[model samples]
Target: MGDDTLIDQVRRRYLEVNGDHPMSEADDVYVREHFVEATPEAMALMLEGRLPLPSYLLSDGTPMVPAEHGRLAEIAGGVDRLHDWFVAFWPDDPATAEEEWGHYLSGQYVCLTEVSPVRIRMKTRRVAEASVAVEILRRDPHDPIGRGMLGQAVDGVLAVPGLESFLLPMTAYDRLRFGGPTVRETWVEAPRREFLTPVAPVWPLRTERLLLRPFRPGDEPALTEAWADEDYTSLLLSGTMNPAEVAEMVRRRSEPGDGTFIGLVAEHDGEVVGDSVLILQGTGLSEGEIGWTVMPRHAGRGYATEAARAVLRLAFEHYGLRRVVANLDARNDRSAALCERLGMRREVHRRGDFWSKGTWTDSYEYALLREEWLAQQP
Candidate 1:
């Protein structure tokens, strides 16, 4: 039967309890409250094989099923609704449901629930007996690696039947409920850093005077020539990186790493004059660090300032970061001036706090909030 027909049948079946006097808008709300919301078990059974499984998958390959009517607003609706959703699927133990709900609410643990009879009917359909390989990772509660990664304290896979399996955070609740050696076991795992998936301003981003592109072979000679100069590298932590070292840096930055670095070389009139980067930091990738390096020959031409502005634009506008910061050696007057030109606020200065090049150097931290950056834009 069609979904509409089934919904109508279920509605009628539910409304029958009220005895047909007359149907009104109130009756629809009544059916939802009593039939759909009240008894989750019956709803689960009734909706079995009917509700479509979410085809959208998180970066980690788990299906992206937002709570309550597929809206994030519902998750923020209230704690009561979150609790109801939890008990609906995990009704066996009412004792710890409250705590489990709290964890899910706070994002301490992310619970992927199999709301209805889920069927793997996607591009790569799973066999009837097949099970998905889950990797549960544990990290500090404060450090989140963005969406699709669970922030909980255990990282491994639970072999739930079929390719579609809910990732139950292996907390005390799951250990008590699932009662498996794997569920009870916990591992202090290192942070899983995947290269960030780039979005917006697609690569080869161009401004009026500069073309920002990813590092490619043959660009290293220009980079080495620029970086090898002590005058250019002065006030820099790495000092003068050798030719081979510069090439290695180019290669590493060219490829994706740890979702932290977005490296791009700035091309001016077909010459690689500098490099620009947007470094994502903090949980949810909500903040970023922006930096640029220009060749000595390219200095005093506003290339660094132009490239830094582009990087800031990418951070605030394209990536949707909450804030962007630039940390530079205190003695780097030119860079500090560039930060001011970009409208970044000087937030911190720590004297002799940073040790670099066999000497203690002061550091400066400049920051630009999203609101501030937006205000500066035309």
Candidate 2:
């Protein structure tokens, strides 16, 4: 090669040492059938690694590479620690030592899948290569185990086999349900490893006399009327909502919040009564704030109290929040009475803490611990 650069020479030598293996017909078929989805680069990587003797093989004759589940790896403190745990649990089999790969793919295949609410049927289909699809019929976010799995799935630590998928608590398995490396399948492209959007606390929460749900378009009329009755007198530079402000409020509440703030509409007898909010705060979302608003005409009926109680339960019971606080104008006796009714302990009575309506106004802060709330539960 005349006048070849040093970089070019190194590249040529590298390719010579690791011979470029052009994609063959069999390789293309294997990739298309095996991976959930693959890029051309990934296919080429698989092809290149084909020559190296794999450390092990699965029952389906698929080569076993070093692989670890994202969440498991995290729990073990690192991939190496996770591998150590695996080795301790799965010692090398003498029978597999005699095989060409010298080991076998051991352990159960565990993954996350979305539970379809519409399909109320649990079905597990096993294919020839052990490819399995489990359909979960019921969607209960309250179940502790199911909640953890859903959280992991949202965090990108757990892989969902498919949307509208099912879940069964994983335990020791006699055989792998999903296909081995030969025909592995997943909805997400493995290499990209994208994370799903974290969702707000589960909703449409109900109390004995009221329904708490997300804001929708048609709710504007009633909500606007409620805002008109709201006394912004004690609030800091805040006033009643105008038409534009009402539209903005509806639009903002309609979009999915980033797991931090949850805005809910309270309904009684098919009429919009008020709104409540749960604001997750502090590190790890360990603490939060609970807020509520009721139309002046509907205030004394205890609609705010009913909805606020449901939201408090959600904070402590569902989200596992350690503490939740509610702050309000100290002069607002209606809200102060509501806090006490909810069993919140008055934590602070800051004097003139807020500069509202061109004057300093006092504020009250009430809080409830998770244990306190749980003990109060019937």
lDDT leader: 1
Q: In model 1, what lDDT does residue 302 have?
A: 94
331-370 per-residue lDDT for model 1 (tens digits): 9899999999999999999899988888899999999988
For residues 200-233, could you state the per-residue lDDT of candidate 2 as single tens digits?
5566787899989988887888867656654633
lDDT of each: 0.56, 0.53
What is the lDDT, from 0 to 100, of the residue 325 in candidate 2?
97
Clashing pairs in 2: 136-166
TM-score of each prediction:
0.53, 0.49
Give RMSD to native, each candidate: 17.7, 13.4
* TM-score, cand. 1 vs. native: 0.53
